[model samples]
Target chain A: MTARLRVVSGLLILAATVPFASWWEAGLVRHVLGHVPLLVAAGALLAPRGGRPVGQPTAIAAVLVAAFCIAFWMIPRWLDAAVNSPAVDAAKMASLVLLAGVPVGWAWPRLAPLARGFVLAQLASMFGILGAVWLAAPVRLCNNYLVDEQTVLGRIALAVAVAMVVAGLVAALAGPGITRARPAA
Target chain B: MRSGGLALVAAVVAAGAGLLWWGTEGLSVFTAETARREAVALAPRVLPDITLQDEAGATITLDALRGKVVLADFIYTRCPTICTVQGSDFEQARAAIRAAGLGDDIALVSISFDPEHDGPEELAFYASRFGGADDIWHFARAPSRADTGALLRAAEVIVLPDGIGGFIHNSAIHVIDPQGRLVRILDDDAWREALVLAQALADDTAAAAPVAGGAGT
Candidate 1:
């Protein structure tokens, strides 16, 4: 990675951990939104541009780890802990960036196009399902957030799901060559 | 190579499941709020002996009210929505208890978590809006913030500021046994169920007391 990109990613991490992190503590919508920039920055920093294909075992492991990391944090108890406790909040940030983002980034270019598509489709569906659940839930899931704030987050999650599907379709249409692993130099 | 990959996948799944089970408090609840309610029900706890000021500006401790089943709820007088509903519900429940002649067995208490703003005057005014506090029903506040926090924590009540001078909090009618242990948390609207449970507990206390008195004699 270029020094410029490294510096940019560092700044993004800083903004996410400092201002966005503090701001998100107030509401669920801000909490979900704050995570996006941090995830993007962390993923981008570690994603390989072009490399020999990673072994199928390693790729699958990385994807599973990423999925588990995301799902674990989405649980309401953990989410509440992240908001209420500074130690848990710091652990949340670290695990998201290191455990989820880093592995997903490393595995993305190595996976076959079909595998990549499958991952994206699964993510979109998960978000959609979670959105519907949050929207329709009778009880507030998180103690720190009010019901209205949860509803807003549900809408945003649905929107994000749609956007992910669109982005995935566009990527697929753009052809396999774009993400195909290159022979290692 | 395929077998090794499958093993790795299996291990990851197992680990994830274990973590989730732990996080959800033995897979009993997905939300912390539910976990808290379930935890209290599973292991009824004796509340801290926090001092509170009644609407009449008299100091009282939770221990002082022992030997009568207490139906308690956390409320702030200034709440715009659910607290009012709870207040009315408490009034109806109080009337129901009195009508049934279970008034001596069951007691209702509304503890103001927002003690900073809900002083004795505010509590009294709020109580007056709902037929006023009597021997059966009382409106009280923990005069100190620390005491309020301790009471809330003991009751597993979660309260957060709504950023508009009001609070967003979980609402429930907590049922405490004659022994002062918080045994059940019923939905705010389930005051009927709360009454039933409190009456049963009060009866048990009554039954046990005579036995203890006989043994002492």
Candidate 2:
């Protein structure tokens, strides 16, 4: 399973870096969509299964790193730089994969249920707030993207935020028993 | 172990803050466009002396326009949307400058980045449509693609093909002083303020001159 997961993760990264990178050059929405796969691949590669228990401090540090990475990349100037400059683009991919994706994946299983819930809630709120700001901004936030594209990306972000919130609530209510039992069965 | 963890966390937080501070230019500029505007405003940049042909096919260089404050905007003749608004804004600005009798002190220029399609004739039509007058208002295009790109880069104007024969670009009134340095960039809607600033700069140039008419030829 681990070997297969690694292969899948590798393929995901390849798809995002090659085709999605070229495809997203023009539109902010497409650019953001392209980031999703990179983030997922990064997490999938480092996903916990039967590893030694991670220390609480390590988990907290990882979470902080991941959060900072995400926030850093989301800044408009940095986002524009990543889009325009090939060097910055490579750095963005590396940081998102290593700092954000890997850290989040490594920290996930180590975090307490309450801490996990808090992370999810924070993510949801952050997305919603960013979405609202993008939608309402009178001027284009990124120089490379059109105002219309920004609005479309904003709507997509809001949808994703809503979906995440719903998923978190469902997971919380359903408990771990159903999910854990299914894999065992 | 707990103290070690705290130290690590503190270090990460400090690093993140530092990166953020640097990335946002000390937290003063939030967007790339804003950063460009702020940087230009802080230190005015001398524009490139690219060869351009006015609507009448006469060759002109930014260096030649050193005595008069120039309000320049980038546009393509075929631009269907924002360029139209820019044209109208320029017309209003031209009228306001003339009314204020600063036409000699201020010159309005629209530079076409799409030089492939916007030749002398096309520019002439665009100028006519906006009531662009000779000398006071000029619709100009670079003679070559390379020169056009250079001017756009010098002015920090980012232009991307819309993939539909149109172009997507950020529009603003770039105010050039009497010394040919790009001193200010105003929003497309702020042409009035741009004109006012240009008049002030022109006045300052005239005042600083050793002799009357020494600034402009």
Candidate 3:
């Protein structure tokens, strides 16, 4: 699909998810799983393309910021605050869409193969660790979510993490020749 | 799309599909029945010790009720809807406790989130109307708006002011064990279940105290 189509699709998904995000159960599902990917897709579509690639250092930093942003949102306190406070909720949206998603989309492809693999490994580990914690926790992690919902989320997260790890491994084995970042135009 | 982009799209699709299933049908590995039971079992969180005023202008601290299984509910005197049902359910639980001769071991507290309209006199009148016996049940109001909000926040109670004059709040009986930790919160009143759980908690506390005393010696 063209960049415009990808952006439109992302926006549409976002618009649809917003209504359900007001609910207790559905809200969490959308916030954690829905908005993150949708924003990333839209951001990727809109990223600076075909220009001189960002420096390896800048790209690495952006990837770190994006990963940190994702991890920050997964904390129980942040989840609780997002549900209760409107300002925090707004911040979650803005930070995910504008700061994390846009930068990661713009920077990830520009980084060297090794750097890209490192970022992927970091993301996979983060998701895997977080998923295990959420799943094994005996008590409810977030005040806003039920134990069952948390478990479901954890399972999904772990599954996605596994998929990401497998994909990363495949790319790594395929070697740098095929996966190398194109030189700056 | 390139192979890499295709893989990315697939990942997104998978995540989205999983989320959609959960958001819509709540289909999870754990059955709904199993989840509910697990939720109830994982209780006894240390409740915050917030003090408010009872109907007689006397200060009531949650810490004071540490030795008693306190069945608490949130309500405002001005509520026209579900609070009435909550009041009835609480009354049933109170009666059940009294009948079981655990009245002294268990206390019922109705906390008013709307301090503006549910002061001492208002709570007193509301309590009496709901069959709130003087010794068994006490109705109280939060000392201030900020204090009330804080108390509610600590309890994880969501209270939203309805566009009307009243508030929409979670209507449930919070069962605080003898240790002051809220052991269970039942929306159904579940008089028998509440009594059984409260008795178990009381028994657990009784069993642990002697061990502690022996250790101290």
Which digits, one per residue and each the tens of the lDDT, describe model 1 over residues B1-217?
A: 7788778878888888888788877877888788778888899999998888999999877788898899999999998899899999999999999999988889999999988899989999999999999999989999899988888877767798887888888889999898889999888999989998988898888888888989585
TM agreement with the true structure for every prediction: 0.88, 0.88, 0.56
lDDT of 1 by residue, A1-185 (tens): 68568657756675666556767567687677666446645754655555666567778788888788878888988888788778998888878777787778777768887788788899899889989999999999998788888898889889999999899878768755644656546
lDDT of each: 0.84, 0.83, 0.70
Sorted on TM-score, highest at the top, how do the candidates line up? 1, 2, 3
Chain A TM-score by candidate, in order: 0.81, 0.83, 0.81
Point out the worst 10-residue segment of candidate 1 chain A by lDDT: A175-184
Residue B18 accuracy (lDDT) in model 1: 85
lDDT by residue for model 2 (A1-185), tens? 47677768766675656455646556788777666446645564755545888667768888888888878888988888887788888788778777887788778878887788888899899989989999999998888887888899889889989999999889877777656756664
DockQ (model 2, Cα): 0.57
Instruction: Provide the TM-score of chain B versus the true chain B for each model in turn.
Output: 0.93, 0.93, 0.81
lDDT of 3 by residue, B1-217 (tens): 3555445545644554554354323443232223322344485467556778999989988898878888888888888887887788778877887788887788888899988877898988888877754777888877889888887876677665555666655566778888787767775456567778788888888888899989585
lDDT against true structure, model 2: 0.83
Error of 3 at B163 (Å): 1.3
Question: Which one wins on DockQ?
Answer: 1
Q: Kindly report the TM-score of the first chain in candidate 2.
A: 0.83
